[model samples]
Target: MTITLYNTATRSKQPLEPIEDGKVSMYVCGPTVYDRAHIGNARAVVVFDMLYRLLRHEYGAESVTYVRNFTDVDDKINARAAEEGRPISEITEETTQWFLDDMAAIGALEPNEMPRATAYVPHMVKMIEGLIEKGHAYAAEGHVLFKVRSYADYGKLSGRSVDDMIAGARVEVAPYKEDPMDFVLWKPSDADTPGWDSPWGRGRPGWHIECSAMAYELLGERFDIHGGGNDLTFPHHENEIAQSKCAGHDFANIWMHNEMLQVEGKKMSKSLGNFFTVRDLLDQGVPGEVIRFVMLSTHYRKPMDWTEQKRVEAEKTLVGWYWMTEDAATGEVPAALIDALRSDLNVSKALMEMHLMAKNGDAAGLLSSMTLLGFPAVNQNLSPSLLEKVQRTNAAPDMLDSNSDLQLFQKKLESLRADALVSKDFSALDDLKGKLGAAGVEVRMTKEGVTLSPGPFFAIENLEVLK
Candidate 1:
C-alpha cells in the first residue's frame, strides 16, 4: 500500500514516493532546549515519530533516516543561563537531557540524528559564506543577512508575498538589513554570550540558519520530508526555503506541519494558567502511554485539545486494551488499521479501527496495532518479578495489609512467578499483573516473596475474584 501525506508546501495530499527507491529521509524541527518540553512540543515530536514508524514499516527500518535538530545555542537558553547563574553549556546540556527524557516517556523514538545547533556552527558559517559568494546574502555591520529578494519563491511555502509579510509579520526592522523581509544568517554575539569565531566576528548562527545548515550537513540538501508545527510555516520555514534554494539545493521534497495544541479549548499559556510541561502531566500520574494516545486520538492536521475529559477517556481505553491483550502474543497488524494510517496518516481513523478490534475480541490484532501505534505492553522485556515491582510502584501505598484475601492473591502471584521462571514465558504472570494494576492493587514480587496491598486507586470490588 502506498503512503500519502498532506504536504504543507504544495497544499495537497500526495503519495509519499521517496526520491530514492527503498529509502526515505526526514527532518523535523526539534526543541530549543531552554527548558522542559511542553505538551505542544511533544505533539510535534510524537506526530513525526508516528510518521517515522509508518515509514519504517513501509520501507525497512534500516532504510529510513530521520533527523531532528536541537537549537542548543539560542537567546532563550542564554537568558535562562544568566538568570540561573549557570554556564550556558550547563543549561543546554541539562535541558537537552530533560527534553530527551520527556519525549521518551511519551514513547517517541529517538531520531537517527539529533544535531545540536552549536555543533554545526562551522557548517553554518560555510553555508553563509557560500550564500554571500553567490550574491544571495550580504554582511552588514558584522551581521550576515540572507537577501530575501534573491530567492524568487520566498513566500511560496507559506502562501504570503514579501510585501504582505513585511506589512503583516512582526519582522525585525534592523537598519543593517537591506529589506525588512531579509532575515539573519549570522549575528555578532557579545562577550557574555555564546559565540563562535567567524569571518563576521565572534558570533552565532541565527535561528533559521541553524536548521538549514544542520539539515544540509546531516541529511544533505534534499530529503524526502521536512516537518514541524504549523506555527513555523511562515518565517522559519520560508526563510529556510529562501536560504536553501538560493544555495542551489532542492531541499525538502514534502513539508509536513502538525496543527498546534490547545488545552481545554483555549490556547495554553502561562498567563492563562493552563500551560503544562510533559513532566507536569507525568508527575500528576498521567502515564506516558496515555499522553501519546490522547495526542493521537485526533488527526495530526487538526488542532488537539488536551482536556481532562480526553485524558481520562484515553486512560480508560488504554487500560481496557492492555488488560484484554495481556496474554496474547503480538500478531500481524490488521490491513484496515494500516490503510487508515496510510491515508494521509489518519491516526483517528486508525484508532477507531482498533476500537472495533477490541469490541470483537481481536486481542492479538489489538496488541499488534497498539504496538504499531507506540503503545507496547508495559515492560514486556523485564523479568516477571521486576515487572511486578514496577506495577506495584505505579500507585504504591506506604503500608501493606496482611489480610486473608491479600495473602491468597499474593500466593497465586508467587505460583505464577515460579512457573514463569522455569518456562521462561511471562504471559500468564504479565496477565495477572495487568489485573492487579487494573484493580488498583500494588503487586510486589521480590526474591523473598510476593506481597499484595491496596494502592491509591484501590477498589476491592475489582479484586474480589482474585481472592
Candidate 2:
C-alpha cells in the first residue's frame, strides 16, 4: 500500500518513499510536561497517532520506528517548580506521568522511543560544538548561538527571507548575539536553574537543539517523517533544519504539521473560558471514545473546533455503534477505509465510510473498521479484554438508576414522543426533553427505543420536579 502525505517542507502531497524500503521512521514533538495537556496538545497527539497506526499497517509493525521526545527541561517547567516550591525532578516526574495517562485515555499508542531532553543533553552539547566548529555557530559570554546567516537556505522550510523573518517574527534581542536572526544553541543556566557542564560553560541546551539531537540519536542522520503542530514551522523547525544540515546530517525527509485547534470557532484561552485540558474533559464524564470521534471527524490539515453539540452527537453515535457491534463476529476490514486513509490520512472520509457501514447494518464490517480506527471494539483475535475496559470507561458518571420514578418518567417521555409523532406536534415532547436535560439526564431516542443516562452534572434531586 502506498501512503501519500502533504509535506510541509515541499508544499505538496508526495508518496512516502522511505530511504530504506519497508522501513519507516517517524518523530513527533511531544509535550513539555509542565502541566496537563490541553485540547490543542491532544489534537497533535491524536493526529500523529493516526499516522503511526497507518504506518504500522502499511509497513510491518516491526519495520516502523516511532520516536516522540519529552521536553523534561524547560523554562516553563522551572517556573512551575518554583511556583509550587518543589524540586524540578518531582514536578517533571508527576507531569510526565500525567501526560502519559491522559494520552493513553485517548487511545494514543506509545511511541517506540520516548527520549527525555535531559537524557540527551550530552548529545545536544556535542551537536552544538560541531556547529561551532563548522562556523554555523559561535560562543559568546558563555552562550552558544546559531548564526542564521551562515546557512544560505535558512528560511526554506518557512519560505521567508531573512529580512522578512526578522521583521515579522518574535526574534529575541540579546546584547550578546551577533545578529537578531540568530537563535540560541546553548544558554547559561544560573545557580538556581538546571545546568550541565559543557565546553562553553555550565549551561543547558536550547529547546530547538534538543529535538535535533534526539532525532539524530534515535532515528539516525536521516528519517522518513518529522511532525508537529504548524505553530512550530517558524523559528523552531527552521532553526532545527539550519543546524542539522550544517552538521552534515540529512535529517528528516518529509515534514508533516497538523493545523491548530479551536473551541467553538474561537481560539482556546484561559481568558475565553473555553480552554480545557484533556483531563478536564475526561473528568467531566466525556468518554475518551467520544473525544477521539469528534477529533477524527475533521480532516487533520483543517482546523478542528470543539463544541458541546459535537460532543453530544459523538456520544449518541458511539452508543449506537456499540449496540450494533455487541453481537457481531470478527470480520475483515473494508478496503475502502484503507483507501481513504492512504490518501493523505483522510480520516474524515474513513469516518464517512464507517457511518455508511453502520447505516447498512454491516455489523461485522463496522466492528473491524472501528477497531482499526483505534476504537475499543471487540477484537477477539487480538485483545478481547479491551472491550471490557472500554465499556467501563465509557459509562457515564452517576448513571441513572432504574427506580420507579425514573422508570415512570421514561415511560411518560416515550408516550409523549409517540403522541407527538402521530399528532405532528413536538412542543410537549420538547418541554419534557428540556426538563431531562436540566436534570443532567441525556435523553437518547431511536426508532428501536429511548435511553436515559446521567450526564456530567447529573443531580438526582433535580428530578423531583419531574415526579
Candidate 3:
C-alpha cells in the first residue's frame, strides 16, 4: 500500500508521492535554542524521527534527506544572553548542544542537515530583499513588514481570516504596519541585542523568516514534507507559507503537524506544577527506549497523555518484545512487520500484532516485527557454564530434578502468577510468562494439568502424567 499521511493543511489523508522517485526531502522545525527541551518539544522530534525511519526503510536510506533546523538567533536567546551577561552566540551554542544531547539520549537520529539560523543570515537578507523588490514587503522605522494584503492566499494554510487574526493578535498595531495582520520580516536591534548589517539596518530576521530562509536554501523552494508541532499551524507556519509562496517558489508540498504532549491529562505547564523536561524524565531512570515508545504509542495527530503508570507500561511492553529474541540463535526478523510499517507507519496496530505474536510463541515473527520498527535484535552470548546449566536442567524431568535452585525459582514464579491473576494484571502476567520462558521454564495452562517443561515445545499428553 502506498503510504498515506493526514495533511493538516488539507485536513485529509493523502498518499505521499515523492517529488522525485524514491527520494524524499523532509524538513522539521527544530527548537529555538534558549532553554532545555521540554517533553512537548521532544514529541515533535520523536514523531518526525519515526517518519524518517519509516521513509528510509521503505525507500532507500540514501534517497532520503532530512533537514531539521536550530533557531540560534531569536528573541529568547537574546533575552537569555542578556540575563546571563553573555554573548548571544555563547548562549545559543550552549543551549543547542544541550538540545542535541537530550535528543540523542532519546535515540533520535540526527538530521541529514542541522542548519542554524545564525549560519543563514545572508539567505534571510536576500529573501527579504526579494520581497521588497516585488512590493510584497516594505521597510518602515528600521523594520521590514510583509504586506499581508499582497498575498491573497495569506491565511490558506491556517484557515484564519485576516480580520480574525488581527483581532486575536496580542501585539498592539505598530505604526509602521499598513495592516495589523502583517508580520515582521526583520526587526531593528538595539546596541545590546544581536544584529546583522541588513538593508533595513543592523537587525535580526524575524522568527518566521528564519524557517523560510533555511528551508528554501536547503531543500529548494518546494520539498516533500515540512513538519512541526500543531501549535506552529498559526502565524508561524502560516507566515512561512506566505513568505515562500510569494517569492515565486512552490514551497513545501506536504505539511505535517504532530499534536501536543500532555502531563497527567492536562497541558504541561509550570504554573500547574506538572512541567517536565526530557532531562528530568531521564534523570528519574526512565529508559530512553521506553520514553520513545510511549511517545509513539499514540498516533502522531493525537494528543499523548504521559503519566508514571503509562511510562511503566511502555517499559514493560518493550521488555516483553526484547525478551522474545534474547535467546534466539538466529537474527532474522519477520517480513510481516516490515509490511505493516510500510503501510503508513501504523505503529500502534503493528505493536498490537506483535503482542499477539508473543502470545502465540512466535519468536521469529516477533523478532522480525521489532526489526521493522528500527530496533534490531542483538546476539546475547551465553557463557559456557550457563549453556551447560541449561542443558543439564533440560535433561531432568520437568525441571524438577535439574537443580536444587529450581524449586525456589518455581515457587517464586508461581507466587508472581498467583498475584497477577488475583490482581487481574494482564501486563504483569504476560511479563512473568516471558521471564519464565527466558529462564527455560515453560508453563502451559490447561484443564488437564499445569505442565511445566524446560523448553517451548512439549508433548500435550505430558500434562496427563503431571496430573
**Candidates in order: C-alpha RMSD to true structure:** 13.0, 8.1, 8.7
Estimate, for each residue in 1-467, the C-alpha lDDT of model 3 and write its tens digit: 67888787888878999998889999899999999999999999988988898888778789999999999887878788888899887888888899998887666889999999989999999999999999999999999999988999878888888877767767568888888778899999999888999987999999999999999988997899999999999879999999998888898888999889899899899999999899898787776666777787777888889887667556545555555555654445455555555565667656656655665567777776665554545433222322333344433232122333334445555666677678987676577566655443566755453445433222122222222
Candidates in order have lDDT scores of 0.84, 0.85, 0.76
Give the per-residue lDDT digits (tens) of candidate 2, residues 1-467: 68999998999999999999989999998999899999899999999999999888888789999999999999999999999999999999999999998888888889999999999999999899899989999999999999999999999998899999778768788999999988889999999999999998898988999999999999999999999999999878998899899999999999999999999999999998999999999888787877888888889999999988778766656665666686788688899999999999999888867766764567888898887788876443222333443366444322123244466788999999999999999999999999889765678999988877644333344576677
Write the candidate numbers in order of decreasing lDDT: 2, 1, 3
Q: Model 1, clash count? A: 0
Q: List, in order, the clash count of every candidate structure.
A: 0, 0, 2
lDDT for model 1, please. 0.84
Q: Please provide, for model 1 over 1-467, each residue's C-alpha lDDT reduced to its tens digit, 9 standing for 90 to 100.
A: 89989999889999998999999999999989889999999999999999999999989899999999999988999999999999999998999999998888888889999989888999989999999999999999999999988888888998988898778758778999899878889999998998999998999999999888888888887989999999999789999988898888899999999999999999999999999999998888788887998899889999999988677656655665665676788899999999999999998888877766765668889889988988867555322332343355444321212244566788888999999999999999999898887765678878898877654234334565655
Q: Which stretches of candidate 1 lie over 4 Å from their true place?
A: 381-467
User: CA shift at 413, candidate 3, in angstroms?
Assistant: 24
Off by over 4 Å in 3: 168-171, 329-336, 374-467
Instruction: Supply the TM-score for candidate 2.
Output: 0.82
- Candidate 2 clashing pairs, residues 3+ apart or interchain: none
What's the residue-level lDDT of 72 in candidate 3? 88
As for lDDT, the candidate ahead, 1 or 2, is 2
